[model samples]
Target: MAVNQMKNRMQALGLLDRSFKAASDDDLGDALERLDDEHREALESFVDEVSVDGVRAGVRTGRIDGGMEAIAAIVTDAALADTIEQLGDHAESPSSEQLREVLPGVVERHRLGVTRIMLAGTVVGEAPASAIIRDLLKNDETLALPPAPEVEIAPLLDTSKRSSDEQAELRAKRKAAKAAKKDAERARRAQSAAARGR
Candidate 1:
């Protein structure tokens, strides 16, 4: 819906038409599974709470599940509930086994910089990639490390001056090609309408 809205707004402003291709429905579904950092923290907090509560309540096996249920219970307001419902679509209203398969990958993706819920709707398609991210997140505490000093970043890669100029030249060429394509499309439309009248 947001993609369609963006395209429609662009068309209305005469910026572009429906020339952009989006990830397919299945890709979107996969992305829905790849939520961000705040979301992972939210789920983990729920798990921890459930673990604590289960210890107090003497429930033996379901601390994690109970914690999640408890967190769900806390989001009772209208706006939060709406957001929850939208995000729950990631759970995909499917079998437990599928959820189990996807949840670890989602958690792994969260550990990376992919923190926006909006982008999650795009990255979930590459399950293998997500799984690798998850494994790295699981085994590597580097994600848990302190932020590096900005001064240390310059030494990591060789600085190159030609890269930006070459990219700018390529961008200019692409813009020219796109303008010609749009002009041709407009001409075709006008010719087709004229032919219909004749």
Candidate 2:
């Protein structure tokens, strides 16, 4: 496959290694941790969809039993799970064993990077590229790192900035307003009492 074509395929499979490398693992982990149950399920489903067992089945037999058997078989085969986990989305969809067989060199070339990045992301507790990309699409900031120190901060005199005197003056005004309200209430009560006496 051409470079552009391979990149496009990799992206469709959801392994953007460059973005994964640039992202902080802590940020990604926090984001994954914060996922609602539904999104967590979706992430798991997505992972299964791209798993090596899923892919190897898709590639070898084109999901002849509609993938259920493949999924079941994967549970028992550590080797297949490891391979699928390494292959990620590259193992899924239209690219079958025949396709790879037909264009072994091209298919291998595209799959190399996809497998490498997926393997790298699966190191221990780090967030996988697939999960991070899914959360990122929903505009979740959990995968985002804190702002860099070099980033330009707002000026110290922004709208919320207030001097000590200004705060004191505001407090005094509030106090005066409270006093005036109390005086008004006293006057009204005195008027009511006087009218009652008459």
Candidate 3:
């Protein structure tokens, strides 16, 4: 993909946000740690997508040394050897430049390891990519989702003990209501088309 397209995708994924860029390592770590399971899953999935896209782009541009096989070998080798973790300590905050260098490797290792085990039937005794990335970056300062809004749900009817005849009558009424709703919707659409034509 084009550079602009990749950049746009990153922005849409919240990878290029100013808040994330400006956030301190400690702040990032705290934010990441606080994420609920749902948010954590989302973050991991997004990271994997971004990592794969980055690799593909590198391959297309001839920036990366080889095809995916070579990339996988490099990541797997690094993961098995524990070089990625040794690159930096979990407690030490890495600079953005350092993160740029290390994030891809971490993501690729996790993704390929899982794929190898599940699809290729090869065992990969490696830690999850999210864990590695969390350890390395210690950042999630701007990724929190807002609390869900409260909702009140009320039942429209209580039909626990309705007779067969009553049930049939209720079904007929529902069918008629649905048909009426569809007619109203069609009329509204026709009016909208007529207005647009004018």
Candidate 2 residues 17-38, lDDT tens each? 3323333444334334444565
- The 10-residue segment with the lowest total lDDT in model 1: 14-23
Q: Which stretches of candidate 3 lie over 4 Å from their true place?
A: 1-149, 155-160
For candidate 1, the per-residue lDDT at 42 reads 46
The TM-score between candidate 1 and the true structure equals 0.21
TM-score of each: 0.21, 0.21, 0.26
Candidate 1, residues 20-136, lDDT tens digits: the string is 011233332333244355553443433333232322232122222232122222221222233334447553333334434544454353322222221221122222234333333
Summing lDDT over every window of 10 consecutive residues in candidate 2, give the lowest-scoring window: 62-71
Write out the backbone clash pairs for model 3.
28-139, 28-140, 29-138, 29-139
lDDT against the true structure, per candidate, is: 0.34, 0.38, 0.38
Residue-level lDDT tens digits of model 3 in 90-174: 3244444554465456435433222221111111112234333323222433222222345789868779789999999999999
The total number of steric clashes, by the backbone 3 Å criterion, in model 2 comes to 1
- lDDT (0-100) at residue 17 of candidate 2? 32
> What lDDT would candidate 2 get against the real structure?
0.38
